[model samples]
Target: MSVAGVGEFGLIDRVTARLTYGSTVLLGPGDDAAVVAAPDARVVATTDVLVEGRHFRRDWSGAHDIGRRAAAANLADVVAMGADPTALLVALCVPTDVATDWVEELADGLGTEAAGVGASVVGGDMSASPTLTIAVTALGDLGGRAPVTRAGARPGDLVALAGRTGYAAAGFTVLSRGFRTPRLLVEAYRRPEVPYPAGPQAAGLGATAMIDVSDGLLADLGHVAKASGVAVDLTRDAFEVPPQMRDAAQALGVDPYAWLLAGGDDHALAATFPPATELPPGWRPIGRVAAGSGVTVDGRPFEGPAGWDHFR
Candidate 1:
C-alpha cells in the first residue's frame, strides 16, 4: 500500500514497532525528542543527507540499501572523531505515492546498520516531498578519550588505513556498464563494509589524526594534509590490489589505481600514528606524513581528479 493510504502516524507506528535500541538510548520513538545517555558528558554529532536521484538510483539500489548507505555515511563520521556511536535520528522526505513497505524497509536498513555498532535509531520525522531524501544525524560518546581530529598529524607520522577501498568504485563502474557478475564490487557499492570499531581502536593506539574516507583516499587525505600542514606521501607498492579489482579493471579497460585513488563511499578509516607505535589489527601502513604540503603518490602529485566533488 502507498504511504498516502497509511497516513503519517500509522506509517511511523509500523516502522518503529519492532526496533531494538541500545542501553544508551534512555528514550526512543514516540516523543518530541529522544533522551540519550551521555555518560562521557560530551557528544560527537554528525549528519549526512542522501537524495534519491543524486545520491542513489532506485533502479540500482533497494530502499534498504539506500537506508544503510545513509546511516553508514553519518556513522562513519562520528567514529572518525574517536567516539562510540550511541543514537541515530533519521528524517525522511518521500512522496505520498511511495510504497509504505519501501519506507519500512528503509527504516529497517537504518536500524540494522546502527545496531551493528551497538547504536539505536531513537527517532526521526517524515514529510511529504517531490523527491525521496534521507537525512541522518548520528550521536556518539568519546568514553573519556580525546576526540581525534584531522589536524594532529605531525611530520614522520605513519599513515595507515583500515577496511577495503576501491571496491565500491569498481562496483559502481560495473553497474554503470550494465553488468553485475562481479558481485563483490557491486555489493561493496551497495553496502560499504565500514570498519566501525577501528576508529576507537586507533584512538586507543594513539592515532595522531583520523578521517572517514568517504571521498577517495587522496581527496580525504588532502584534507588531513591541509589541516595538519604536512605533506602525505603514499607508496604505490604499499597497497595490495585485490585480484577481483584487477580482473574488473582489465575487463573494463580502466586502471584499478584510479578507483583506489579517486573513488569515494567505501567509508574506510584513514589514520595517522607516531612512527614507532605498533599498528592496530586491520590497519596497515600505506604512506607517511612528511614535511611540506599537499599529498603525493610515490613522491609525485596524483595525475587525475583526487576524488568526488559534489560540484565540479
Candidate 2:
C-alpha cells in the first residue's frame, strides 16, 4: 500500500477517485489542468503551505486533519477578503515510504472540507519530499462585493469578531501537558472550527477592515493596524472566554488570557465596523480602532512575542 508500490499516477487516481465536484468546477481532476468558473470575473485567491513537524505532526494528527487544516487556512483567507470559496488546488509532497491509503485519506479530508464551503479540489500536483508538505491555493468569488483588505480601518471603527478563539492554544497545552479531560479543547487543536460564513457576511454588512485569525488576535490585528496606520485597542472583558479554555487554563495553572490573546489557527474572522453599525448575527464587538500604531489590550501595548514567527 506504500505510494511507491502504486507509482505516482496510480496514487493520483486513488486520491481523485472519491473527490466530488460542484457547479463552480467546470472541470476536475484528470486533465493537464482543471477549470473552475469565476462568476464575478474577479477571483479572490490565497495559498498556504503546511509542513509536517512544523505545522503538524503525524503522531499528533491524522492525515485527514492535516489536510483539513491546510484547506481551512487557505480558504479562510479568501473568506476574509469577502469572497465565497469556489475551488482549491492542492499540491502534496510526501515521502515514498508513506502509504497510498494515507494520501488518499488526505485527499478525502481536503475534498470533504472544501465541499463544506461549496468548493472543489479541481487540480494539484504531487512530488517526493524529504518530509510531508501540503500547499493549497483557495479560489473564491467576490459576488460583486468589494474585497475587504486589511487596510481600511478608520480611527473610530469598532473591532468585532465572529467565532470563538483560543481553543487551539488550549488544546495544544492539553496535549503538551498530557491532560485528557476536556475533549473539546483537545479536538479543537486537532481540527479547528473555522467561521467560514462569517467572512462574506461581515463584508456584506460594511466591515471596514478584516483578517483571518491565523496568527493570534493581537498579532494578526497588528497587520491590520500597521497596514491601516491605526492602533487596535481590545478590552479584556470584551472577549467571552469559553468555558473549555477556562477549565483548561485551570488545569495548566496559567492565565487563559494568553491563549486567547496570543494563540493562532482559530481562523475566526476579525473585522472593523462603523461605530454605530449593528453587528451582523454571530458577530460580537470586541474592540475599537485608534489613531496610533500596534495593538493594545485595555489601552496597553502588547509586549509578548507575536504569534507563529516562522523564522524566529
Candidate 3:
C-alpha cells in the first residue's frame, strides 16, 4: 500500500492495538489525558519532546532506539526525584510515508525501556507531520517518601553517582569520526540503559540531593549546586572511561573529558549524601558539597558550555 493509502489513524491503529495497557491504567488511551491511580501522596511527572534531526536521526537510530530514548529520557526525570515510574503517555508525529512496522518498532522500544524502569505505556496519540516528533510524559510514585530534589543538597554532603559517563558522547564522537557504531558506544547512543534503580536506592540511603546526568556531568551537577546553594567539585582525574572510550576519543582527536564532563544523554544518577551515609552499590564517590554555589572540577571552575537546551 502507498503512503497516501495508509492514513495516520490507520497506521496508528495498527501499532496501538499491539500494545498492552497495564492493570493500573484507570483510563487508558482514547482520552484527553489518561487517568492513573495515584496511591502515593505525590506523583512525580516529567515530559520530554524529541524532534527528528535534533534529538535523533533516523539515519543513526532505529525506530526502537528512538522509542527507548524517548521513554528513558523522561523516565530518568522521575527517577531523579527518587520515584518509581508507574505509567507513560506518548504522542508521536510522523510523515505520511513512514512505515507501519517502524511505528511498531517504536512502540516496542518504548515498551522495552518502560518495562526496564518498572512502568508501562498507558496511552498515546499519532498524527501526520512533515518530520517525526515524539513527546513522552512519564508518571511516577514516591511511595510516601519525599522527593530528593536538587535543592536538598547541604554543605559537607558527599557527592556520588551511579552509572557510567561519556559513553553516549563517545559514541557520538565515534559517529562523527565516520566510524560505524562500536558495540559499547553504539548501545550507548542507540539505547542508553539508565541505572533506574539507583535513584530510589539513593533515597533509601538518605540522599540529600539528586539529579539525573542527562546533560553533561558538570552541567547537571551545577543544577544541584545552584539549587542547593552549595558548591560541587568533581575529581575528573578519578573519573575514568572504559578503554573502548579512550580508543574512540583518541581516534576522534577529542578529549575524553569533554565527553565525560560536558556530553549529555548519559542518564546517570548524581546525588549528594551526608557524610555518614553509606554509598549504594554500583555507585562511586566523585565529589563533595561545599558552602557555596556553582560546580567546580577538581576544586576549580569547570570551563565549558552549560548543557543541552532545546533553544540555545
Candidate 4:
C-alpha cells in the first residue's frame, strides 16, 4: 500500500510499534527527541546517510542487508571514536509504493544490527520520497573513559587493525565481474561485521588514537596522520591477502592492491598504540606511527584515490 494511504503518523505508528528497546532509553518512540541515559557522562554521536543508487542497489541487496549496512556504517563511526554504541536513530525516506513488508523487514534489520552493538532503536521518523534514503544517527557512551581521538596518535606507536581488510572490496569486484565464486565477498558487501568490542578494548589498552577504516587503509590512516600531525608507515608485507581475494583479483585482472589499499567501506578499526601495548585477540599489527605527516605503505608514498568523499 502507498504510504499516502497510511499517512505519516500512522506509518510511524505501524513501523515503530514493533521495535524492542533496551532499558538504557529513558524515553523512546513518540517523543520530540529521544531521551537516553548515558550515565557514563560522555556520549558519542555520529551520522551517515545512504542514498539508494549512490550507496546501494535494492536489486543487489536485500532489505535486511541494506538496513544492517546503514546501521553498521554509523555504529562503526561511533566505535572508531572509542565509544560503546548505545542507541540508533534512523530516518527513512521511501517511495509510497514501497512495500510495508519491506519497510518492516528493514526495521527488523536495523534492530538486529543495533542489538549486535548492544544498542537499540529508540526513535526515528519516516517520510515519502521518490527513492529510498536512510539517514542513521548513532549514539554511544564512553564508559567514563577518555575518547581516543584521531589526533592523539604519536610517533613510535604501533598501528593495528581489528577486522577484515579487503573483503568488502573483493565483494564489490566480484559483483562487478558477474562472477559467483566467493560467498564471503558478497556477504562482506551486504553486512559488514564491525569489531564492536574492539573500540572499548583499544581504549582500555591505552590506544593513543583510533579510527574505523571506512575509506581505504592508506586514506583513513592519512586522516589519523593529519589529525595527529604524524606519519603512518604501513608494512604491506604484513597483510595476508585471502585466497578468495587473490582468485577474484586474477579473474578481474585488476590490481588487488587497490582493493586492499584504496577500497573503503569495510568499517574495520585501525588503532595506534604505544610500542609496548598488548594487542587484543583479532587485532593485527600492520604498521607503525612515525614522526612526519602523510602515509606510506612500506615507507613509500601511497598513490591512490584520497578516500570516500560525499562530493568528489
Identify the leading candidate in terms of lDDT. Answer: 1
Worst 10 residues of 3 by lDDT: 303-312
What is the C-alpha lDDT profile of model 1 across 234-309, one tens digit per residue?
Answer: 9889877899999998998877888887788899999999999898679999999999999999999877542233
Give the alpha carbon lDDT tens digit for every residue of 246-266 in model 4.
887777775666777777778
lDDT of 4: 0.86
- Candidate 2 lDDT by residue in tens digits, 1-312: 898899989888888888999999998999989889998999888899998888888877788888888888988999999999999998899999999988988898899889999999999999888899999999999999999999999999999988768888778778777776588887788888889999999889999999999888888899999999999999899877788778777766757777888788878889999899898678998899999899999999755443233111
Between candidates 1 and 3, name the one with more favorable lDDT.
1
Clashing pairs in 3: none
Task: Mark the regions of model 3 whose C-alpha exceeds 4 Å error after superposition.
Answer: 1-4, 303-312
Question: Each prediction's Cα lDDT score?
Answer: 0.91, 0.87, 0.83, 0.86
lDDT of 3: 0.83
Global Cα RMSD, each model = 1.7, 2.1, 2.5, 2.3
Off by over 4 Å in 2: 303-312
Task: Give the per-residue lDDT digits (tens) of candidate 3, residues 1-312.
Answer: 523467766765766676766655787666677788778867899999999988898888899998999999999999989899989988888887877788888999898888776688988877888988999999999988789999999899899989877888778667656777567997798788799999888888899999998877888888898899889888877788778887876776666777788787879999999988888578899998998888888888865442222111
Report the number of backbone clashes for model 2.
0
Q: Tell me which residue pairs clash in candidate 1.
A: none
TM-score ranking from best candidate downward: 1, 2, 4, 3
The TM-scores, one per candidate, come to 0.97, 0.95, 0.93, 0.95
Candidate 3 TM-score, C-alpha based:
0.93
